[model samples]
Target: MLKKIDRAAAFIQKESELFRCPMCHQQLTAKEKSLVCSNGHRFDLSKKGTPYFLKHQVQTDYNQAMFQHRRKLIMNGMYQPLIDVLTPYCEGERILDVGCGEGSFLSQLATSAQLKPSVGFDISKEGIYLASDYGENLFWCVADLTNLPFQMGSFTRVLNIFSPSNYQEFKRVLVPGGKVIKVVPGSEYLKELRQAFYPEDETKQHYSNEAVIDKFQETFTKITRKTLKYTFDIPENCRLSLLEMSPLEWGVSPENKAQVQKNPLKQITIDLEILIGEFL
Candidate 1:
């Protein structure tokens, strides 16, 4: 088996031209165990097989335990409906998944769609650490969305799934006519969980996509929106794992958590809207 550093070095050597120095915007080249740029900015690949791209350390509420359950849920086909909708548009030479937590969606998409040179990055190091254990062919990195460490027009398809959007950076790194497959939570997404946690909070009972869609319109042309709504029957034993996977439950009271654990949900809604955007 190739050592972790060896695998990382190979990936960097193959795709180094696609990356840029976040500090100086210069092309990066793979050196001994590091990606270095003309400006002397160097990024070292971690022992876990992910490169550090963020300028500063960021603390996140997302932890390994949470991501582990997320991987299980995704692998078991919780988001299969969404994947089906996204498969057709996944055609491209290079694909990028922004804010790819644990790389579950991107890894599945790459494998199912038979895509090569698939790359995924997240601001959370914990998430990227888990993601590095995914396919060896895919490149995983801990990177900030606002300041992507890539060259202009680098990707043919950019995926933004239930993650924050950085339109400017996205557009900068997308080829002309490249597609941005953005997934946003629909109004009914996780309604059961919301109701369980915030039963009396009227505002928390519903969601709105109008604002998010409107913002997309401002930056992208030929925008198309598709709604994917489904109900996933939760196995009695997996209900707790589902609850733990969601960041929404992070701030809930311990009593509320126990309540959800006790009265397991039979089915959970997976309502989402996928927006396909092309640059003008």
Candidate 2:
């Protein structure tokens, strides 16, 4: 709707200072329906109310339906324990969530406190479009992770939940002493589904967070890690979403997927590591 485009215009104009031109790295000014950088690189707010910033079309398996299912799974309180862990860091902070598909995580964080500046962006336009459906306090955009569009030293906290990370880009947008809070999966994350789909494949059954954890440790100067484990009883309505939500499903055979869907796991494990670091 045209109204959605205008709804976020005021927020963009107010927080225009946080943005940098993705192409030229110049300061950007928010116009009526677009963001124009000094060198004249303009990204319009069309298709979705959010500004479109990615230079190239991103073709990925995380399509609109996947994002919809993912969002439903999140909002169903599957991530409430994870949310409880993330709430303390978000109090009164200007936060940026990279790979913030469908905006569920940031929206939940925003509900915990009043965050004047909250922005969530993903490479997929579909995800951003779905994101706009959640809340108005946050700004949604289609942005590339490798080249974030925010200025250096802009946010107090940057959130990356179950998404890819680019430490350099995150560091570039955060001020000195700002924290990076990331969520990495534990080995048993979704073990039930993994066992159902890929029981024989050792690698497929267990998530390997070794490389990612090592990278997170190496990228920040000071960091804290917390591992939280919980299990949620899947409601009947969301059973299919559980089956369709994860990218891990992409590898399963059609027959296996159908069979499993008919008898999907009633409970799911939420094993995750929360990393918080600052002073990089």
Candidate 3:
């Protein structure tokens, strides 16, 4: 197998235009183990094959083990529907997955689009490190959503899945007719998980994407919206994974946790809306 750095460097070299110095906003050149810009700003590449593009370290609740379980659930095809719906909307040779955790969604979408030199970045170092496992054809990095480390008008398709949105930065990095495909949770998204944990909390039992969609509409004059709702049966093996994978787990009571562990949920909701629009 190729060393991690070996695989990542190859793609970085091929898709250098997707990157710029986050600190200096200058053109970046790929090197053996680092990226250097014309203005002398350098970002060291992790030995794991991903680059550190954040101006400073960021502390996030998303941990390595959580990402591992998340990837486990994802690999089991929990998010395949989202990927299927995203395929036809994807355009251009390259794509960017914003806030990509463990890189599973981007990896799957890249395959669907036959995208070359796909890029995925998140503020979580642990997430980015784990994402390096998919680095053979895709480049991964540690970056912020508010200040992406890429050149303006470099990408034709940008993906923001169940993650924060920074429309200003999104527009800066996308081509004139580029698209931003964002996925936000629907009211029933993960209802079972919520009922199991916070049974009486009405707020926890549901969600609303109105404000998020409203903001998206405010940014783009025109857009397409579609809701894909389904329930995924939890394989016996993935029951524990389901418990550990969600941020929802953070608020569960210890008693509730044990109860769910004793009687694993049969299925969980995957209701989400996909919002697609142009850079304008």
Tens-digit lDDT string for candidate 1 (1-280): 8877678788888888789999999999999779999989999989977889988899998898999988888887889888888888885458999989999998877877878687899988989989988766788899988899999998899999989998889989998898899999999998999999878776877869889888887878889988889999876667778888978887778888799888878899998988998977
Candidate 2 worst ten-residue window by lDDT: 1-10
Q: Which lDDT values do the candidates have, in the order given?
A: 0.87, 0.86, 0.86
Candidate 2: give its CA RMSD in angstroms: 1.5
Our tally of clashes for model 2 stands at: 0
Tens-digit lDDT track of model 3 for 64-111 = 999999999999988898888888887335788899999999888777
Could you tell me the TM-score of candidate 3? 0.96
Candidate 1 wrongly placed segments (more than 4 Å): none
What is the clash count of model 1?
0
Q: TM-scores of all models?
A: 0.96, 0.96, 0.96
TM-score of 2: 0.96
TM-score of 1: 0.96
The pairs that clash in candidate 3 are: none
All-Cα superposition RMSD per candidate: 1.3, 1.5, 1.3
Error of 1 at 268 (Å): 0.4
Candidate 2 structure quality by residue, lDDT tens digits, 125-242: 8888999886567889989999999999889999998899888888889888899999988999999999888867887886588899988888887799999999999988898899
Off by over 4 Å in 2: none
